[model samples]
Target: WHWPTAWCHMFLAPLFAATGLLLRLLLRLLLDLHALFFLPHREAEGFKEQGNAFYIKKDYEEAFNYYTKAIDMCPKNASYYGNRAATLMMLYRYREALEDAQQSVRLDNSFMKGHLREGKCHLSLGNAMAARRCFQKVLELEPDNGQAQQELKNAEAILEYERMAEIGFEKRDFRMVSFPFLRCVMRPLTAASFRQISAPLSGFLLSSPRSDILRMDSTNADALYVRGLCLYYEDCIDKAVQFFVQALRMAPDHDKARLACRNAKALKAKKEEGNKAFKEGSYEAAYELYSEALTIDPNNIKTNAKLYCNRATVGSKLKKLDQAIEDCSKAIKLDETYIKAYLRRAQCYMDTEQYEEAVRDYEKVYQTEKTKEHKHLLKNAQLELKKSKRKDYYKVLGVDKNATEEEIKKAYRKRALLHHPDRHSSATPEVQKEEEKKFKEVGEAFSVLSDPKKKSRYDSGQDLEDDGMNMGDFDANNIFKAFFGGPGGFSFEASGPGNFFFQFG
Candidate 1:
């Protein structure tokens, strides 16, 4: 029985060893399959290493390319997809990055990074609604996403602007006509949000899919361009120009960068031209150039006000009193605190004999005046107003108050010949209208004063006292008969042989 047991043990021991080896091999095979199908560990590791190197060098395009390769190798890897989407966003390819981010979240719905990336992508694409959804998802997953909370707030603000625009349009408010659609759409993006989104998105959009191409890497060029634009808006023109030039050197085909450079140059040239004209005493020319500059950039407050003030000066010099007033009015409209416009307009009104208007303009200037020159201008305007108000109509017409009818007629005709609308046919429409009104008033004044009966009635206190008298009480026909004498007043009768008309009245 002992010998039989020993033989069984030897046979069973080999069988057991074989069984154990087989189980070990099966476990190894399953582990390898898991790594291969779900992770692609080796390929992903290689791509990740390459991506890290590129990212360190700020070469976002190359980084994005490697990250994308890593994602392709490990299709279910949320980290790889999230990283790649981040790189793409750097290139300004927000729409494409958004897809990748969405894919990452679809694969790994619990990944907070994926949701954050998706929200950022949506923000770049001006999809505030989608972005808010992703941000909300991030908050739900990680409740401590401060960045997401801020972004959501920004998106809400932009949405509000769009809503306001829609309301304005529905209400037919023409004042809101200049609101840009993109401005309304991206109202949520503050300067801080712009800096955050643009920096990454620029790199992603300009980068090539191939990781090895250095020339195709647009990270540096895009960064320079974005920084330049920010500087430009911040009023750092020289620094902005430098960045723009550097961006052009890095990427010559960059249209937006080139445009920024050109605009900066044009603005500088326009400013220089206007300054030159102003220095040379060509106020009108200076004003025109400044106006053109303002047209190019309506936000240029200095140029807008400068052009208006300069134009006012030119109008004043040209004796275009109304035009001077208008120019000053525009200046004040652009800058309500502009004391110069009020002073200039006051001067213009005084010149035009509009004493009441001049007084009002002077009072406004006095209230707002800060400089000594402004105060002096206000004082001068007040003095001029007093002088203009005291002007005698007879002195204006260059005739005595009791001038003969013939003298008044002669004076009126002479004045009308010089100040008639036809005489100023070459003037602007506004100027012509003003001159016409003035001439009409002058003619009417002359007509009333030249009429003996009307003049007598005007001189007496009776005409002023008769407040309830109608036009029928005047009896102008009787007045004319009394002035000319007889029924056929001043008739021409040919002295013939015999014509005796005897009236027994």
Candidate 2:
């Protein structure tokens, strides 16, 4: 064992070196295990906190970098992916944010913030339907989430606006289609005070879900303009004008604010002129002025609705019955509760002898107003409609309603003789048929009018005793025979009218 001391020294030195290398490898593996099991978790948590701090400071790029680092350290952590997604959204990388959000939800389907971020991305990218589903999913996870409720309302309002606009386009109704986006964009912020007006304007305020940009930076021109829109739609025209002017001052190139301001001013001026003209009884001038006002801003739904109604009134005065009806209908479409429009349309329908349409409009007016005048109009329309349905027996017989019995018999006899079918038997079939029809009408008129009971009933607007009565009930031949003495007693010359003398058959 102790042979050759130099060889023993060489072997011992090599064995010690190998043992040292093995010990070093074991220590390195232990360090790697520590970094894997403990250090990464701590580092990832620290990175996530840093990312949140940058996010709170609104430093989106730095936030994005930190969140990405956290994700790199903890790739399967749903919260890291969600945080990264939110930072990506703040950076305006919606597509990338959407991917991260989706991944976060896939990693942990119950992550409400991940779903919220995904919904936000979808909304920003104009996928309202998809955004709605995401918000709905969030609500399913946390039913009382106020943010998700508001966002869900926003998506639903957008979809409803689109549906209404499509219906208006299909019906060729401009009132229903105009201002839909404006209304839809205003929904979530003013749902209680202004129930009828809503909007889906997700980015109009240019703010993230966590904080309002306008609150942070009041000089944002676009935000100011959107506020102006809200005021303008709420009928606060002066305040809206002020905001619009402020926006224009902040951003000199703000074309929409300038146009809105101009339109608001012009609308007020033209509407006032229209009112002046109407008060002065200058209906033609009023109609022109109101029409001009309507063309100024189609997005001003309330003002345009009023303008349409005013124009309808002027149209009524100018005897433009059809145009008046159309204008009133437009006003009603713009504002379904517009009682004045219904009244105007009813009057136009009355003038046009459209009693059924008049009745419908008057009924709506009466239902909404419940006023004595509206009720009277509704009743009058119903009466006129009832009378219109019945044949004017006196008119058909060429006699006045007050014609005496003798006068009625005389008129009927003359009309019957003139339109007798046999007298025109040699004429064309069409002419013969027409003569026969008139002959039957004359006889029926006599049958109804010559009888005192029937005449009284007819004059009183009561239905005849026989509801199924027709020309057959009148028996023109029998009436002719009875009037001329007997069935075979009288005949007429068929050749010409002047040679018609009764002869015994």
Candidate 3:
């Protein structure tokens, strides 16, 4: 029994030894395989070395990718961030580059290359004040840095010129709005005139400091944005938008310029829409669009006045005469020399039979407008006012301008019966009041026409102007409707005594 136990023990010990060696070899092979699949070939420094190689070759895009990997691996490494920022600048990704440059400086404040890259990034972003500080810091760390000194000088020059341009824009641009009278006077001028007007700035354009900054450093976002504002004010909209977009591309943080760009685009689109609707004779739609334009750009006085005048024209077409007159008056008040407003209001007054008021408005137009059509309109208004002042007693009585005394009497009696207030007593109170006023008008006309001398004076256009009518107090539209035959036609001549229901109040 002891010998057999010794044999089993010896075989078991050998078997266990062989199994342990095989297991050890298997474990070692698995560890090597795992490392091959999952472990990196190098650390952040190695990745940055590759990035540097690409950067030296000027393959910025490839360099940026490698540097991004280095940053992901060792976020605390200032040199990694600094190198990546340099690559991003080469790629024209200034905003992204600026962030990296700032972080690189923050991680290791004494890293001179980080500070140098940070200064360049700030300069590119148009932060001249910040760039100056960074370059000053670089000089503190390394006193005789020629590159930093040159950049500092450039930043100072840019800052100074930007200050001067802003001052000029503020002082000179305001004069454009203050003189509304000059807007119409300048409208006939071509783009060449605008260029000539901006010729004062033309020197600025030829040696544009802002433009110079952009040319030297395409990522000067603030300088680019300021130039966009100047161009926008000059009415160079497309060029303005281009500059604004480039500014935003370089610096996403430029909120003020972004908002201005959006509003300018919206205003331009809405004006075009308004013009299209007006041309299509969709006056109602056009009016709403013009109203939107005014609301969007109320500060542009010349544009707002033109919008008001156009809306007034639509109001006239829509039969909103009073509102049209009100709008036209506002437009004329804004630009007193606006001949179109005067013409529009004059025509409205003529339609309402306020010939004296029409004459005044027409006279204003004639003073500004030398067109033959306006001159003829002025003549008509003057003639109508002369005829209106005499109170056309014969026309008021619905008798022929040459009717005999007996016929005038008969016509008066007929009109009196037709317009008696009692006949309208069952109608609305407003109608009844109008009927009473009209009855008085008829009675006054009858009294004058029956008197031979007064009648002759009224006919000869020399009657008393005060006692008969103040045209505004009457509903001339209703009177015209009634005097015309069947709501369709009427002669300029006073018709024979008809069943006239002259509206008055």
Candidate 4:
């Protein structure tokens, strides 16, 4: 059956093509089977389990190694990459963590934790905008995720803060003049007009508008003065002083620049002395130095604000709480966006038992920073405020929230003796009545706080008035007798409310 040459050639080509296709398919099957047998899924899973164990133990380095091994065995596994990303994040390797987190999300787009890790990496790297997007993606994946919600809020706050900071800077700088004429004419004229009319000029081509003017006309005294003002406001003291000096050199008769330069130098020196004294625990010296700095540069709002804040800190150390609060307020007035001043004022408020003011300041701080510590402080202030609205057992007894049972007992014993009605017998009727009221309050406080269930209920914000814990029903005299075995057991010498001496029989 010999066919024609052309037909035979056609048949052989088809047969060869089919055979090659079958061979390739068979080779791929063999490779897959080899992978299944040699690269055991169980082994990879074991490595992942080991990684998890190390992670639980907080041994991030060991966990990273095991996760890497697991990834090597199962390159397509999103979970392995996610786990490694978490380990890297614990090590503060945000860039590496970001890469792994991205890879994990690429492998499994639906992986919520992968997106969460990616968001956290973005946040740690200070890319709040990117972090916001990642957190939004996580919310899309898992709508009820609490961590994602909080992180999204944090990212939004940071972005808002940064936006406000930029606006503030623009407002302070003359470069952002919005008038069409000034925007178009004054800006270009300041930078390029001198260059065009005068000889070719050259200096450091800096990134600021004033710096541009300086680059064209380095000897321009007014531009130098303005540049120095920018640095001075930015809190770059030494650089600002240098620019001011340069301006004075360019025009010795420039009184404004001369005054600024002198004030900058004096302020810097005084601020340094204040800081040194503060670090050495000399609160009075620090206060004096900071005050001097404030006086040296009353016109320098930014620097004066910082000096006020520094003095506030010294005042706090000296237990001059009112002065500290006033100083913080002055700082806040000078720079409304001053976070440190707000925080300092909040602490002073807490120290002075102004719980409501403290809560407000802490809330502001939390809104800006949104850190765990800030949240904690805000919560504590709120709790104190709540307690203040009711009978503040801790405040009445002069005890802390974490006071031990023995400490509570000691505080109760001391308070009972001080507020005892008999102790104020020689005082006026108004004083006696006030002492009586305080005595009753002390008894009610002890009644609630001495009982574990009552204390817990009070601390958790439960209404104790409905829980058979009425102050009217509480007997101050009976409680005092029970605690101190009556006046016969303990003799007290008292001239007034604060002066009491007890001698136990």
Which is the leading candidate under TM-score?
Answer: 4
In model 1, the runs with Cα more than 4 Å from the true position are 1-5, 9-11, 20-24, 27-39, 174-505
Separate clash counts for every candidate: 16, 10, 0, 0
A best-first ranking of the candidates according to their lDDT comes to 2, 4, 3, 1
Q: For residues 201-272, what per-residue lDDT tens digits would candidate 3 score against the true structure?
A: 434543544554356546767566655655665556677788888989988888856876886687678878
Over 1-505, each residue of candidate 2 has an lDDT whose tens digit, in order, gives 5677889788898999999999999999999999887799899999999999999999989999998898898899999999989888766557789999999999999999999999988876667789899999999999999999999888787777767766665664434644474465434332222223323232232223543435644697866776677678755788789889999999989887888799888888999999999999999989999988887765566778889989988888888889989999888976788888888898899889899999999988787788898888898899879978978888889998788888888898889889988787778999999999988888888888887887777776777856554545667888888887887887776446546665666
- Error (Å) of candidate 1 at residue 228 is 16
- The lDDT for every candidate, in the order shown, is 0.66, 0.79, 0.70, 0.79
User: Clashing pairs in model 3?
Assistant: none
Order the candidate numbers by TM-score, best to worst: 4, 2, 3, 1
- Give me the candidate number with maximum lDDT: 2
When summed lDDT is taken over every stretch of 10 residues in candidate 2, the lowest stretch is 189-198
TM-score for all models, in order of appearance: 0.37, 0.47, 0.38, 0.49
**How much is 232 displaced in model 1, in angstroms?**
14
**Candidate 1's TM-score:** 0.37
lDDT of 4 at 351: 91
